[model samples]
Target: MTPAPRDRILDATLTCVARVGLGKTTLDDVAREAGLARATLYRYFPGKQPLISALVAREAARLGADLLEATAACRTLEDAVVELVTTAVASLEAHAALQYVLLVEPEVLLPYLAFRRADDFLREASALVAPALEAFLPSDRVARAAEWLVRVVQSYACSPTAEVDLNDPVSVRVLVTEFVLPGLVPSNMLGVTS
Candidate 1:
């Protein structure tokens, strides 16, 4: 299926980022991937920061849906949380927007990593993870739990494992099963959680 205009820009941005890194992902490269002219891209994005912001918004929306669905389907809060965190990490690894932001402009990841909000962009991310957490965990514990899960997600994001190696389902699964799941549950259940 043809990607939508916003998606087209994101796809192009990822492609450009992968090829030349964020520093070289020019408007022309983005336009070429979107199959739109440079002028057309500019009609939407006045400049690179605008384009990057749009891409971040698009990715956040997609991830919000994926996380909510994963969270709702789980039988328990623990299961839901693990599924939610793993889904996010996997999505980041798969989505070029996530990688581009992580690799190119790390400040973009401050919300996920640091949860700072000098601007409101990161708030959408909290909206995505908060509902599931609220469903089972008390409101008081929600922030800390989400913060912990975010760290786990970022751990995988910055894993020393080469992209190809970490791409393996076994390696990805191990991260959650060994590291994340245990951490989520108290030490007693750590053995049984598996």
Candidate 2:
């Protein structure tokens, strides 16, 4: 089955972005990548900002769906959290366009990561991740925990740490045990004392 024109355009946009970076990827590039006319591309997206926005929305939805599915089989909250982090990290690492932006044109993300925009983006991310966490955390704690979890996953995926490599399951377990689980799970469950 073929994807709709908009989907095709967005996919082509990512291909172009991955190849040339977002700043250098013009509508002509995306149009050519999609094998569609420039007029057809404009018919779907009036401008570059709108096209970028649609692409971001599409990717976010895809990530959210993947996360929900990946964590669905976990038997415990700790397992769920571990799966969440590992899955999210894996997905982020697999995104070519995003990886390119982060590695080659990090400044492209600066505006979104700053002040008010940061909060909005975090809130949106929290909402996407919150559903996967609901089964593991209390209703009231879910949102806050999701926000924190998103922050942790994003931070680790973006900057990484020598102490914990999210790509490694064993290391992810250690991270969940010593850091993540301790926060989401009660101290008694973790056998910890102040």
Candidate 3:
């Protein structure tokens, strides 16, 4: 079945946002892209901020699903971190919504995708990496660790020390494991042998 006009508008806008950036995308652009009238665009979006909010929300849900799937196979906490790092870096390179969040509207990512309390965001994030992290971190720290991973990935992507290779997703993945993951581990165990 064909999607509703609102959904169609969103789809077209997402494609445009991914390609031209959310700041540059216009109602006219979305209308042309969606094959709708400008007035019709207003019928759905009302304004740019509403459209942007919908786009960001939809993208967050999509990425959350992807993150859940990618980390499902993880067997250990380090493995979970590795999978999350790999998947997140790779997603940033491929997904338009993530591109918008990472490259254009970073504030969208700041909210962390929890429809409920911000803490729910941490719980959802932890579920993504339960395989590896369930064993490594204490119960109380699991959610906190999840939030940390999310922030670390964004920082890594935005870091100026070395640019992430858009084509080589592993470059950022490796960077995450080497630099960020170690810090997430507790310091009291540092003296212990691996």
lDDT of each: 0.67, 0.87, 0.68
| Candidate 1, position 194, lDDT | 19
| Predicted candidate 2 versus true structure: per-residue lDDT over 68-143, tens digit per residue | 9998888777787888888988898899999999989998897777687899989999998999888766678789
Off by over 4 Å in 1: 1-3, 100-127, 155-194
Candidate 1 per-residue C-alpha lDDT over 1-194 given as tens digits, one digit per residue, 9 for 90 to 100 = 88777777877887787677666688988898789988888987889999877766676777878888877766666566667766776787786644666777876456545545522433445566776676656567566566666655555556654632344545555665676555555666444321
Model 1: lDDT equals: 0.67
The whole-model C-alpha lDDT of candidate 2 against the native structure comes to 0.87
Most lDDT-accurate candidate? 2
Which digits, one per residue and each the tens of the lDDT, describe model 3 over residues 16-70? 8778776678889999999999999998889999998887667666666676677
Q: What RMSD does each model have against the real structure?
A: 5.5, 3.1, 6.1
Provide the TM-score for each candidate, comma-separated: 0.66, 0.91, 0.65
**How many pairs in model 2 have backbone atoms within 3 A of each other, for residues 3 or more apart or on separate chains, i.e. clashes?**
0
Candidate 2 — which pairs collide? none
Off by over 4 Å in 2: 188-194
The true-versus-predicted C-alpha distance at residue 186 of model 2, in Å, is 3.9
Pick by TM-score: 1 or 3, better one: 1
